[model samples]
Target: MAKANVKTVEKAVEKVVNLPAGEKIERDGGEVTALDAASIRLVMQGWEIRKKIDELDAQLKSINAQLIEAHGAGASLVVHGVCRASIAEREAVKITNAERLKAVLGFRFTDLVKTEIAYKPEAKLIEMAADGDEPMAPSIRECLTVGKSASVTWRAEK
Candidate 1:
């Protein structure tokens, strides 16, 4: 039993290591290649759970699509001892381009849409700060601490 478990774990580790992107994770100073076993195990567990969820979600979506196709739009389905599923419709009012609408509407745009001044970081200034060189270096340092977070696109297929 222990041997089988160890082999299973080894295969999991091999699979993760064989992957191009997920092998080394980034740390404060640089990428860390040698991760602890517990950390790796936790990540593997999360991956396994997410894979199962993705499979279930795909199946649910396909089944829902079938139901919608069979019933057409704005319909419902009831399964005995189960539940009711809906393809109910609702109107969504969306202003995709508020700037264009404001330009075209002139004054009446205010009635429909509320506007506010939004301050956003400029990329060049951030780059200058990162490179430790610029006229805006002091200002960028004072005003902003530019940082990045992980962005994940799940690979559904192994």
Candidate 2:
């Protein structure tokens, strides 16, 4: 019986060895061969996985494009204020025009959609002398002191 089993195995090996590497071996019984069936399924599964990955890649690219567009339209401002507290200090240049300030704040200057300014004195005081004229407010000096930082937000005009 051992010899017979060895002969049967030898015949099976001989039958497979002559055919191409990937070609299926003929069988009489209703049974599936592992290698042939697995290769076909692998090919099909790989195509499906590639298709899904392509769809996801397209979606990611669209989202990134939108983010780039939004970032271009809006940006953050960093205002650095330098303070010089000296007995004799040069006058501070007040930024009165909204359009000019807006240009200074951003790389690309454009007309302002709206302008607003909040100050402690609540008035735009140029200068004064002796007499009953109101003395210059300390806050005005503070505002003029360069290096003293403050940030004002404004919408960019379309």
Candidate 3:
């Protein structure tokens, strides 16, 4: 047996994309080629499966909430001779008044706080300054950095 060449494969792929509706190309062993139609169909099927999975997940969450309400938190239970489930408790802290709290507990507050500097371009401010508008602010006008980024995206045609 001989291996297929890259050019041959590319041509085959191009042919597949340009195939007319209701037409299919097959390999030697009656295997269907992965053409645009098959690819689109698979994508649509995957979306449908994702929707069903989301629905099942919501139902499971509702059932879990009911079970937790009936048995209380941290109660372990077995179901279907396979699954074991339990609801665990966790604690979280949110700082409502950082400035006031820091004033009250000076050194201790430093332990809980993190500070960092981030650099970003102010394009609009730069443009305004370029167009002869009043300087946005003396301090920021001098400190603003300029940069560019490029990205690519793909979408299906409507």
Query: TM-scores of the models, in the given order?
Result: 0.46, 0.25, 0.48
TM-score of 1: 0.46
Q: For residue 145, give model 2's deviation from the true position in Å.
A: 46
lDDT digits (tens) for residues 44-137 of candidate 1: 8899999999999898777866766677656655665556676644432233444544454457445534445633334443455456555544
lDDT of each: 0.56, 0.43, 0.52
Q: Write the per-residue lDDT of candidate 3 for residues 29-132, one digit (tens) a residue.
A: 67664446676666667889999999998987778767767776666666554566766544322334445544544664444344335222234434443454
How does candidate 3 score on lDDT? 0.52
Ranking of predictions according to lDDT: 1, 3, 2
Q: With candidate 1 superimposed using the best TM-score fit, by how many Å does residue 13's alpha carbon deviate from the native?
A: 14
CA deviation > 4 Å runs, candidate 3: 1-35, 112-158
Model 1 residue runs over 4 Å out of place are 1-26, 31-33, 96-100, 116-158
Reference-based lDDT, residue 137, model 1? 47
Work out candidate 3's RMSD over C-alphas: 19.9
- Best of the two (1, 3) by lDDT: 1
Q: Which run of 10 residues does model 2 get worst, by summed lDDT?
A: 82-91
